[model samples]
Target chain A: MIPAGPAGAHVRHWQRFTFTERVMRSLFYIVVLIGIVWSLQSIEIIPEFLYDAPQQTADLFVRMWPIDWGWYPKVVHAALMETLHTATLGTILAVAMATPVALLVARNVTRSVLLNSIGRFILVATRSVHAMIWALFFVAVFGPGALAGTLAIAVHSIGFTGKFLSEAIEEAKPGPIEALKAAGAPPLAVLIKGIWPQVKPAFLALAMFRWDINVRESAVLGLVGGGGLGMALDTALSNLYWDQAGLVLAVIFGIVIVAEIATSWARSRII
Target chain B: MDASAPIKPPVDDAGVDRTLIIRSLTKAYRAGQPVLKNVSLKVEGRGMTAIIGPSGTGKSTLIRCINRLVDPTAGEILFLDQDIAKLNGRALRQMRRRIGMVFQEYNLVERLSVIENVLTGRLGYVPVWRAWLRRFKARDIERAFQLLDAVGLGALATQRADQLSGGQRQRVGIARALMQEPDLILADEPTSSLDPKTSVEIMELIAKRAGERDIPVIVNIHNVALARRFADRVVGMSKGEIVFDGPPRDLEDSHLLQIYGGEGWLE
Candidate 1:
């Protein structure tokens, strides 16, 4: 209702937040500040190490000034290829595994509450554990090979890919599905002709994005004894070959940039 | 309105019982409050039957109930020698194949090409693998294109459904409905989203095409004038009950007042 002032004068009043809301917001900000201060007090810092951090960083960079380009042909080349394969294969595996999980998780697609919960459980379980931790677990099982890295990437990606794909499925317009159902199309037919077409672009775009992220994640998998360029870097660092380690870092950085650019371009084309 | 007049069911030239009988149909989304209150309607074998009423009068619900899209809480929907309300699973799907439906929003799959959307009408009849492979039968493809041509959309066969204008999408929707080789058609507010000119054109297309095929069409329409122009029979509903049932020429202003509950909008 519009409020009127005395003597029939027009009165307009607008505030984004009510007084109670403003008070609650102020309380929230104070609590956040207290939490930050409490956390700062808990994590102890060494004053000597903190003071010389810049100097230490400069010394390390100086030791790695001359990158050993010669290391590329001997070891980095094969490891780089292995990293790409892990990312690519892992993504394909993740997409394949996540498709059914996504279907189950989407409320519109799977009406059963039990199935949705199971799907949700799987998504949360796979996603809660970081890729590096997953790599360590798989490396223990697979004995520190490329298989471990691929498995790690795929498992970690299931939660991400399935979540997005299920969201896409749920967001699909129901009009076409209803139209097809009215035409007496079978359940499978409706899914193919109605839902698939609607979600295909989003599916492809998400898959590409997952693959891009997987590439970067897979690159570091070897640090945990899963196979990739990180293994080569591990070897160089263990052997005190700073120049070789620098070359591996440079290569990884370059490849990540390339993967980002390529995936963005491909996503644009698909969407 | 002499609404107590008995409806004489008509048979088509093929001697098929195309009459759709609804007896005391009632629907309640919630337990006690009914959206349709003991509604009953009879759609004869041929020509257009328009259900006209104000919004939320169960016009759309009544049409959907015939094909079992919206299940009636109580009543019988007798069509084609079967009780549509009781059919389940495969039996229900088989019954639905003979009934085609058009929508207010022209619900074509937005990413699918025009011809594919039209072919969706055949998805019920074709094998699932055929739809998956885009390997529809030769005759079905020919007929889809022919129907598209009939709707003046032959040139836009390969275009995505989302790329078309509202009128064009509704044309595709009509073509898709016709492609089913249906015995009956149900259209729920098919032209409510179109402009006046396009609305008229769409109504004309529905009437003409269904007329040529001798298929009975029950359309839920808000535009009383379009219903009068295109429908052979008019069913006026108010508060979930059939208030008037007669020919378009006999739909007087008094009937409109009774159905819509206001004399102000009559002008």
Candidate 2:
């Protein structure tokens, strides 16, 4: 028999390079090229602007710094509550609507391919429109209030929550459902007993996650006249009350932090 | 020793009075590729009737057809004189309450407590609101506890299903089935996931309890030895058709070869 070292070398010589390694190298080069392009675009080093450039942005930031400090308390109390209310209403309505829609969208759960396709199309339509644009549309219809913001957030969240919930439902073990069916349980019973148990925790966790995101989105809905803390922030900025705007920013930051912590705690308990 | 002994049969033959009848049952997932073709069999009201078959031979499909899990494309399934194939919605659910099923994987709701998982068997009997609220009647809870005790899982009532060992989970699964107070128990590869020792123990428990209750069991199994050990009658399937139907003693090596299609492994 040949020595172990020479035998290993012979084996190595016979082995061909894998397709995966070649693909990985190509991907690395493409990623580096894209990063360089993005960096150059971000710094405006390519002379792409036509008017009112990055200097205007810096000027606006400087002009919006010193806000009206005395207006802080009122702004924080009222606007903060509105933001929370929008998030609460939006998340609740979104979760309720998405629950049924997700059942339709999930391939394993939905028996009809046509229905599943329709459900997926609806989700795509809802998600393609950003929350801000949805807020603008709702403002056009509902005339600028928390209702508009709530509707905006609800529509956007339905897309996100429906997709996530459907994925969770699809990935659940098929064994329990089969067992239920064999036990002579009806379709609805199988869904309740087998599917619901597997998906409930994930659905709850997703709802909590959406609530946190909705709070942040609700704060900005006022910028598009959909009504919330964003309206106050926009007003302060337009009037050059930089100190009051600064205070509002601080309050929004605090609310986001608190919402994050609460959502995280709730998620931990559930999963 | 007396306490551990299997329950003795009473004079009343309530279990023997019931029967399941199937006539020309046929199931096709697609237009032409039938999983069960013109299959017809009857199960006696008591004792274990094991269905032995190779993989992809429609053994599961046959059991599923009995409960209408996969709707038969043609023919009739009569359970206690009712045309079970025609049942829909509430009628089907009510019928299902009396037919319990045990799975290969011990399909307990993993996040639920063993007792809570067992309580689900009562879903067909309990009102929807009651099930939602988990407010099963006091009698039902008592019965659930009793069944848990009978299945030897009394102490594991509060434990999450995923925490239990495979044998322990199967015990809980049996208890859950018993909680339904079903007239028939259908076990689909119930011991396929277990080791030989555990499989024997589980099969013994299933056979003993089912016998005591006088409830008939239609078990789909791959192991010929286990089937011979426990089953009163064996039904062998090959390529979606029943090739042999007889007592274990009558199931000769030639029949096994005919059913499974090779004699190389019989040695």
Candidate 3:
């Protein structure tokens, strides 16, 4: 029994979760723990390899030390150029392709439910498949070159760019659009003048972000014959040239850092 | 043939047929719940007619119905020799351009330059490519600058709309509305967002500019004092119906009580 102090208050209690909710959350954690243990038991890790991992890493680093500096001008240079070209060209092409799809996906822009669904389906299909798998497919069709790599990156990026762009478009303020409509501007004019200006900052930021990601992802596309730095690394590993592999890895790490810095600067400037 | 024959519009002292006649206009956002009910009124060709009412009394719906922004569920709105309720597509757009509206929020595109937002008023007259390229005709550009000067925002023409204060933004909104070279102006609570002094100034600017051009204005306002000071006539609304309509000199405490209902705040 609780003592009543005020007319409207007998007992005032608050909680983040109900009793049943807490119990369910505990059960979920328990199930997750059991699943992790089951997975560990099924994999049957070899204790010898696990224990030797640190030493093996140290040995690999020792072999990779004093990397092949001469390899930079010979094999890595052309492959690095090819990788950059693949990413840049793919991003440009994706921008061209994704703009229309983003328009279709934005509910305020495209009114038809069926068209929105189709646009969503396209985004899901492109994004669900990994860029490497796309590279493999394009390699089969195009017979392995920068073209296949470029195509793979472009197709995979359409979903990422389109999804974000459509969201930006949807988030644009409705007030200006309504004002333009009241002014009797045509539908296309409304979009170009009213909606486009509002979403321009977000659109530019998204493009820069996606391009940054594409640079990193396209680096590995050459492993599947997509023609980039990964091809050079693959060749070096097969021949057991740790020095050349080390050069490739160092170049990739440097390029990624550079790309990140450049994109972040550009994003700041744009917004 | 009679139906097709054009009827001559009734011209007042302003020598323009800016007459707006609404007959039984009704709007129901849903099936049996109406926001506006059987409203009928006639506006003259010149001077400000203020519609004063409490919030949610459909003053906005009444004004929006004139531009067909909110589609009316029933009745005929007769303006410029055509029934506004019956227009669609290109016809409706053409009609809307002739009537300028100022919003309570002063909804100028914030990212655009103040002058560019003013030029948007000419969108209905210009081609789409010209708008896209920002290659507005020389006359329109000149006129936009003149309007900015008229609104006392001449120096701020190049600035972005978001950088403006609330009053300045509303001034830009007025300039944009005037840029349409409209026959009629509908101001739905234009001064509601500004301070007391700014509110009086905005009302003065609207009255002066629209009066100079003989463009009749219909303003919806909450401040009865501002309405009385600027509006030649006042129409009062309560619960989706016009409860009173008369000259401001004739409005009294009795009418205010009827319009706002249960108001100790009328002092």
Candidate 4:
């Protein structure tokens, strides 16, 4: 063992690895960097546009201003209302569906391995895919309306709410469940009396949060012919009515801000 | 005979068979290392029997075995002539309703109101679907209110369980146990989480209630003084076997040394 002056003296003092390791790592990084550059180049991305972005944005805003204030009464009566309808309907239906699924997915509550895994896989699958794709699928099947938008949001909510609510169910206090069981409460009774009450606050909070997100997401679903304000925005942009599109953006911004405030306030009070 | 007097066979319902018989009960969480080693004890109708031992001596397990909460590895627990150890499904559920348990932790559903937690004790008697609608029978609700009053929590019935102090919560726990109208009550160190005064109060409540109802109670107690004070019979265990079984007056310091395995604490 004492044969060497220092075991790693041959390696450079500044380097953490041997020469071969250093060369191989540097070469690997160089290849990765070149690959990223090549991919960016292929996409025809203009890095220089970053400098001109502010100016272009300002010009776009100028075009969008001079509010289509008169057109608001006409659009608000139908499209904006439809967007709200889609979000509310989707949230109601999703919560109805997610309650049982969440119980089945929670490791502490679920009885069977096969059933639990299937529930987990379904949640993971739905969560992994984007809502836009769900909208497209529903649109293709249902022929593009508030129905498509509602179904899309509903399906996505199952993933979001199911995963979060199941975790809350799992984290529920075991003492209460044990007490309930010791009282000879049946399985269903135990769920209602023991588990549900403990997780209810968290589930309510998540449900409201999902509804908030759905309102925003539903607003844009119309771009892909699902319905709502996105359709109105798409139409205005296509017809070169920049002022109308600007009004739609303003409405969306206003609604989202209000919804966030409302949801958080409600969550605080309820929880 | 009075017209309202119910017809009955020539037998005493007051002294009816509420006796619990256990034959060679054994339990092991893992393969070979057993927690209870072929233990057997019988509890007669009514009054309190306390099991006292050092920590981890399978006292809780033995109490749980009577209710079939922890399955005995090899045993027969005969409650009212039926072998509960062999029962399953609906039969087991029927058995469990008659056996109430109190935990070391009061284990109240903290978010629920005191009255609602008390009503959960009737879950076995009511259909599951009825609970979904919050539809407890009127009599059960009225009885729950009575139990709350009996437990000295009548004013706090509407309060959330977590809002109460430790003793108040344990009072609710006792009310819940009584609500079951159980034939046997298992108190698994019911006073462990309580202060000394509260512990004595809880024991008195358990003993008084079981006496009123003529239901036998098995308690896994840590405090020997409380055991001697409340328990009609004291069973001592060491290394998962019952080493002493007699009336409370006979549980001498020498037996404590044998059961708890130390001489210094006796002083």
Report the C-alpha displacement of residue A181, candidate 1, in angstroms: 0.7
Taking every candidate in turn, the Cα RMSD to the unseen true structure, in Å, is 4.8, 6.5, 3.2, 4.7
User: Looking at candidate 2, what is the lDDT of residue B100?
Assistant: 91
Q: Write one digit per residue (lDDT tens) for candidate 2, span B21-60.
A: 8889888999899988899897767789999989999999
RMSD of model 2 against the true structure: 6.5
**Candidate 1 on A1-271: residue-level lDDT in tens?**
5457777767678999999999999999999999999997889778899999999999889988899999899999999999999999999999999999999999998999999999999999999999999999998898997999999999999999999999999999999999999999999998899999999999999999998999999988999988989899999999999999999999999999999999999988887
Model 2: which docking level applies?
A: acceptable
Docking class of 3: medium
As for candidate 3, its clashing pairs are none
For model 3, the local distance difference test gives 0.92
Residue B211, model 3: Cα distance from true site in angstroms: 1.0
lDDT of each: 0.93, 0.85, 0.92, 0.88
Give the Å shift of residue B51 in candidate 3: 0.7
Q: Pick the candidate with the highest TM-score.
A: 3
- What TM-score against the true fold does each predicted structure earn? 0.93, 0.84, 0.94, 0.91
lDDT of 3 by residue, B1-267 (tens): 144444445454434577899999999999798889999999987899999999999999999999998999999999876899999999999988889989999999999999999999888778999999999999999999999999999999999999999999999999988998888899999999999999999999999999988899999999999999999999999988999999999999999999999868876
Off by over 4 Å in 1: A1-34, B1-15
Instruction: Give fnat (model 2).
Output: 0.47
Q: What TM-score, to 2 decimals, does candidate 4 have?
A: 0.91
DockQ-wise, the better of 1 and 2 is: 1
Worst 10 residues of 1 chain A by lDDT: A1-10
Q: DockQ (Cα-based) per candidate?
A: 0.74, 0.42, 0.71, 0.65
Error of 3 at A61 (Å): 1.4
Model 4, position A112: C-alpha lDDT score = 91
